[model samples]
Target: MVIYGVYIVSKSGGLIFNHDHNIPKVETEKVFSFPIDLTLEYDPKKVSVAFGQKDGINVGHILTSINGVAVNGNTTEEGNDVKELIENEGNYPLTLKFSRPKMTTNEKIFLASMFYPLFAIASQLSPEPKSSGIEVLEADTFKLHCFQTLTGVKFMTVAETTQTGMDVFLRKIYELYSDYVLKNPFYSLEMPIRCELFDANLQGLLEQIEKTGITNI
Candidate 1:
């Protein structure tokens, strides 16, 4: 559960920095649980919720506005407004509005098979990763668990199932990065990070996980 890879994205959608922690040098067996993917169509600007799950988020609705900003399907806002929203959202409750799509009986019956796992192209959408929790995707050879951020960064691990608290974990990483990396006067924007404090904190996270006996699957 402690495997981590973090990177920062730029406004133009570029990855200017990354920090890796405890990447596996050897392959291992993967485990997976039943996953319910609730996304239709892969536009980050437009999000949806899918129906039918045990512990579902019930995200089977169309995204309307976030933080009072209307998503008018306008490209003009991408550069200025969207960029600012992604980068400078400092510890605010993200308020989102959504509308559900009317579904046909046949569509509802067949929707279960349309689970959208992490596609290969998902990584290239942003220059940096986004703010997302960890989820498991059953691949051909293995089930991969990933921690994805909305800006285009993904922290992946090969495991049996996805775990919760990845967002909480990542926010902790960001807080430390903002303090030890961004707040550091010598740290240049988007440059490759070489911070000892960040590394030390990351290492501490690994130690904490091991000490608590957190199971991987």
Candidate 2:
């Protein structure tokens, strides 16, 4: 049987996360197997686990016993074990383990469903600007660039033309930047927004504008 633990770390090399499972939450009667193969299933994306052999021990061959009930994979079915068996009530453990190995069909489906919308949004967020004729203004307070698109629309940016720009005419850019870029939990002030989430939101807004049938100026 495989023994496993979950841990989260900062990009800066800080130990900011950890989790261990003691109980199962979801039902696995029809799904899962021994030697669980874990994969992340979430929007905004999340971390997943992969086990390795240790001391010649096959960690992938382990089984999970939740509340005296045995199930395979890294997830547990509801009622097989008491809720919060792994962590505690209201506290979600970041890591879990399973008996047996291999990714379950249900697990893969769940992961895909969880990430598909995010993936769609990301595809939309790619920077495919529709050429707007706006002029860039170089000034002390901020630098600006402008472009005019084929549609007779004007696009302008101030102070380094980030995903977010200063002031109106560029309000959408600023709003997109403020909410999706600046307000991101992981982003710092003045930092560029280049994550999957940012891209998704950006694409969504641009698509909305495109659909509105507004002529550009």
Candidate 3:
């Protein structure tokens, strides 16, 4: 019934399929072609979606409400309402409502590539826009945690489950950038992070961290 462990609603609002991370197996066919940039954060509420894909949710789909509760103003309040509703609903299929605007290129590709936040793409993509904070997310296999700086640089890692000290870990990553990549005159200031030295150091750091046992991560 489900492909790719996820159901996608087509552009024409047609029934594609249904599945979630809890699903054990997903065929490869039911994949979303478009790279989605959803406005999970309520602040600076302008656009809801972005990027290119044919049979997928287009750019600029205005999310009006979640589970019949309108997202009027005060996103924190609306976010709470959504959370309570979902908890009470026992995690069933949610009736989401949104308005579609004419699709256009967002043209803001600051990052050359995204590291495929598996949880975001599979389950949902949104976060409370605050500061360089850490969030732990559930995924099909591993627990995914991320921290993003104000300047929009993101560092993420996969673990077996949620752990503390994640904020500190993310800060260490930023520190590595400050010490190696940014200071190097030859390194270009960009999103893709194409510095070989940075990559090597990051991997070495990860390996060192990995040996500390799962809970420490």
- Each model's lDDT: 0.46, 0.36, 0.44
TM-score for all models, in order of appearance: 0.37, 0.23, 0.36
Q: What lDDT score is found at residue 109 in candidate 3?
A: 23
Per-residue CA lDDT of model 1 for 82-178, tens digit only, reads 3334335462444544454444434522421222222334544545675233255565544545444454344334332343445455556566666
Q: Which stretches of model 3 miss by more than 4 angstroms?
A: 1-134, 162-164, 213-217
Candidate 3: tens digits of C-alpha lDDT, residues 87-191: 354545555454553223221121112333432343353454432333566676556555655554555544545344555665766787778766888754442
lDDT per residue for candidate 2 within 83-164, as digits (tens), equals 2343344333223433334445455335434433433354466576532212344554345443333322223332322323
TM-score: model 1 vs. ground truth: 0.37
Q: What's the candidate order when arranged by decreasing lDDT?
A: 1, 3, 2
State which candidate has the highest TM-score. Answer: 1
